[model samples]
Target: MANPQLHLLELNAKTGEVFLRLRKFPNIILTPPRWEDEPLLIPYLNDPRVCDWLSGPPYPYTLQDSKDFLARIKPPADEVIQHLKDADPAAAPIIVGECPVWSIREVRGSEEVFLGGISIIRCENGELMGPNGVDWENKKKREEENNALAVGDPSIIWTIGDWLAPSHHGRGIMTDVIRTLLNDWAVPRMGVRHVWATAFTGNEGSVKVFLKNGFKLVTTHENHVVVKGKMRGLHLLEWQYEG
Candidate 1:
């Protein structure tokens, strides 16, 4: 549920481009990352202030790391790019899978500043159901249980993750980003009725962004995960479309 003051976004398929325009901040947009953004990611992602909060990107983020990440997302991105480029009048361009990412940028004339990244990943109940981030010894049972659930079948379940360049902190940029994603882009395009978000308990700024976007605090999982050899409590939030 986004702030009603902001309206829905249209990802025009016929334009052959994938970008999200913010209603409140017209200059800022979310687009797929390009190869040229390698150096940009290095500086932003390697900053300890940003990487420390993230579990995915490695510390001292390298060019190879960027390449690997970009390569992994290439398939789906290519699909969306192509669809958007040559889509029929009736086609609705979309990128659907376990993880769909976007690069947040502030467009300034011909230049686009890479602020950070965001992802809306489709997840399973088995993963979300667990409080402790632990590996099971019974590998066979784990596989069997996970196999039982189909991919994106119950499309209603999903979660979001995001990180911003340290410079962009305290600007309420991420808050509007989530608002635009839910109320504008993701809701209508993906039919995402339910979204869950989690942040380490002490990360109040991150938690507040989702809160501003209408997510309600569900519960805090104490010592739910280990980051950098330190156990951290996690706050889980839930948002359901009232529409």
Candidate 2:
């Protein structure tokens, strides 16, 4: 069984517009992926950095691989609802956790959708190694630091896995996506206290997004991520939402 932490839900394409309801942020429409988007998703999955974080695709990715993955993500049975009570509301609209997971999509012309990105909450008890490099002795210390930094309330760390289409890059699409996610979680529900994000030191693009969205740099590792075989520095960031 899929970890109850992760479950899928389907929404009527019309209601899915709830995904695009944010008028303040315009670059993104929060709709599902259309069947034609498989072509777009393929290149995103095949992108060098994207492939690094994901498990499959043997280097030069093939179109067939993309098609196969989509075939696996069949459409929803009926309208779906995901409930994520313990998740950080300031992160992504796609909630993924022990509570619930939501997948946002763009409605197609008549009856279809497209997949966007996955937003997840990863819990750590100070014993596990986090993306930034906390293990054993340092783990407890970091957790304590995080707790102290949070000033006593529970800390909900956030991370995003965005395979955003290239055409969408630099267009403020990501910013729109994040704002909508925050709005949904900040009102009429449990509000998140803080959010965490990490980016390879050189990824200026992602760094900007996090900053623009309110995430601040908390720490940085001189050489953290190993991509294509080389260790690169990483920046650890955080954000707090007030609603």
Candidate 3:
């Protein structure tokens, strides 16, 4: 059977950001998620706070459900990295840094530490998806169509996702974590100049994070996302760095 490693290269786009060409993370000292993390991930997924905005995998997300999820989530060796340490069932692990793309923990340290993940589509010149340049036929089309681009033009924008353990909530952990990822990682590694985030309109907490982090409210679309069988509005936000 062909190893999944063979497909790992597929994770990169000639036009997007270039990841380190190996399995191990360079410049990051985080542990991988052990099988035990299933329990941690399960409760978070089932949390109404997190689940409400996400497209459902069904309510009452269970340990079995998390197991199935982890089982299916094969990390792309080159582009996707998962860090793990044996997690103590009693508490959340301290994470110092995380995968810049998916925001998975890459640096685990103190228990109260907060980690955030960020992903930026790297756009490069002379590639199949579309060559990099001023020509944004593909990107404009994606914006106009309300379509999902698996990874977007790296040069133009970075799609950021923020994840935090429940214990770390409401104390500016997520905001600080996001700032750290953008300042310390994404801009440095991926040359990301702009950050984009989508939050369900009703998710005031998330929207506040984006706003507090300097993302300007650009637009809103009604019925943009389906969650729990209902359509909800979504807010589009952007933070640009002119420097």
Provide the clashing-pair count of each candidate structure. 2, 10, 18
Q: Which candidate gets the maximum TM-score versus the true structure?
A: 1
Across 1-243, the per-residue lDDT of candidate 1 in tens digits comes to 322212233343555345778778888888776776777888877787787777778777899999998877766766645544454434444433332338888989877788988887653224454445433344444445544545434435677889888887998899988888776656765567778888887788989999999999988878776777778887888898899
TM-scores of the candidates are 0.79, 0.59, 0.57
Best by lDDT: 1
lDDT string, candidate 2, 1-243, tens digits: 222211222234454422333345432344433346557666667676566544334455667766675564423311222333233455454332221223444434564344456453332334333565545567776565544433124364545545455555676666666666555542122235566666777778778887888888877777554655668676777777664
Q: Is candidate 1 or candidate 2 better by TM-score?
A: 1
Which residue pairs collide in model 1, if any?
16-84, 16-85
Higher TM-score: candidate 1 or 3?
A: 1
Kindly list the per-residue Cα lDDT of model 3 for residues 1-243, writing each as its tens digit. 312322221222333322322123332322223355566666666777667765535677887887775564324422233222233324433222224234334333433122322333322211112344223456555443322423323345456655555555686656655665566545553346766677778878788888887899877777654667788886777888767
User: Which of the predicted structures, 2 or 3, would earn the higher TM-score when compared with the native?
Assistant: 2
Candidate 3: lDDT of 195?
A: 67
Candidate 1, superposed: residue stretches over 4 Å from native: 1-16, 84-87, 91-101, 130-155
In what order do the candidates fall by TM-score, top score first? 1, 2, 3
